[model samples]
Target: TIEMKADKTLSSVLSARAFNALMMVDFWNPIYSWRRAVLMQYVPGTASFDPESSRYDLEDAFITNVKKSGLYTQGDRESLEIQFISLLEVELEQHQKRIQAYLNHARDRLKTSEGLLGCLTLAESRR
Candidate 1:
């Protein structure tokens, strides 16, 4: 019960942080576009841009857009993109591991509770 209540607060905090991060990344960034592409890969035909396109194509579009807005160079783009994607992948992997661990813990707790309930039922039958 306490965990559920805490999760409500945690959910709000996480949603806000996620939204902030999404804004910070900006829609033009290839990383953001690539993330969306990867997430939506399983869906049917899309109304917007095709998600099956190469990440390099996405990066080129990002570079072209950025160049239109400001002075970004071709050389720095690769280095910066490599760093951003690598760091993002590492963070995502860590979150996945944490989620898996939490699920395993919850499953063990459920099994323990079920075993206890079974024991109680057996005792009631003996009476």
Candidate 2:
């Protein structure tokens, strides 16, 4: 899991682009089959993990910290969440387009090489 700030600054964009490029390569030959991503705007306050307690408690603590940050009000939280979802959807669409373009280029190169090889074989046969 890669964690990054979603502020969309220059550094953030570069980091995301690098990560996306890595993911594209990994998609073809995966070192791991599954990739889980989490994007959050604000850093959460530190909390202690309790093996005895349920996961819900830990999650609640994190959420509480997010609210305490005062970056988003209740209404703003819903709007921001929707915006983030939209951003992710657009990013996925763009990534798919990039993958398709790469595949098409590779296929075209393969076809051209095969055609050239076939012509050479035909010339040799004629000789």
Candidate 3:
């Protein structure tokens, strides 16, 4: 009969709750989100870019920081513009829809206020 012997060591490490706490910060103002359409739609007229610098500097600041970090790179200037154009298009479309809705609401409010003012003016004239 041949005798066989084996030796082995096993270990395991598990971390169910190990975590790091981080504060979430958003650098954009709520009001700027509404007006960003104007900024994003164009790269601007006073841009300074050449062998000294690159074009993305002037236009890139307006993109939300998250998107800027995700989509931007030193080499992808044209791609950045294309992506900005698409994002700007979407933002502008949504802005237009919101503006239309606001205009409609304003029209309704104006009509109601005018009617009330007319009623008050007529009532005053009767006195």
Candidate 4:
């Protein structure tokens, strides 16, 4: 979890329109479907994610510590993969809902505004 400063803007706290534009362009625009994650894992293994120092690597703690304990039985990787996929699907669905609501609000704003593009139709002469 990358903690922002206490005075972070609302847009910073939540997802912004720029993120939506990128999602539309890069990943193929999604309407009813939820967005997909870049990786099935929490973080890809490498220098990018250091379990020793990063505050966000808590997911692997169970596999590393709890699984390593002598008293505990080893987990089934296939079952764990199934559960992780289910959990991620739910998370992405919620994110999709939020982005949809945000886009709706933006469209409403544009519709109500007196800006040039706000007019219902463009005249051929004006072009």
Residues 11-123 of candidate 3 have per-residue lDDT tens digits of: 11101110000000111223333333433443333433333432223334334342445345333654433344344444444545655786677567557878668757865
lDDT of 1 by residue, 37-123 (tens): 432222223122223641113323333343433223343554433333333434545545655786677567557878668757865
Query: After TM-score superposition, what is the CA distance of residue 110 in candidate 3 from its true location, in Å?
Result: 0.3
Q: Highest TM-score: which candidate?
A: 3
Ranking by lDDT: 2, 4, 1, 3
- Weakest lDDT window of 10 consecutive positions for candidate 4: 38-47
Instruction: Please list the residue runs of candidate 2 whose C-alpha ends up more than 4 Å from where it truly belongs after superposition.
Output: 1-22, 25-28, 31-90, 114-127
* Model 3 stretches astray by more than 4 angstroms: 1-47, 51-56, 62-91, 114-127
- Candidate 2 lDDT, 11-110, residue by residue in tens: 4223354345335533543444232122243324343333354121333443344445544345364443333323333465677897788778756755
Residue lDDT tens for model 4, 7-98: 54445322343233224322323432233242223232421234364323333442343334433333454343333333333445665776
Q: Write down the TM-score for model 3.
A: 0.29
Give per-residue lDDT, candidate 2, residue 66: 42
Give TM-scores for every candidate, taking all chains together and pairing residue i with residue i: 0.23, 0.27, 0.29, 0.24
**How much is the lDDT of residue 81 in candidate 1?**
35
Q: 23, model 3: CA deviation in Å?
A: 28
The lDDT per prediction is 0.39, 0.45, 0.36, 0.40
Q: Which scores greater on lDDT, model 3 or model 4?
A: 4
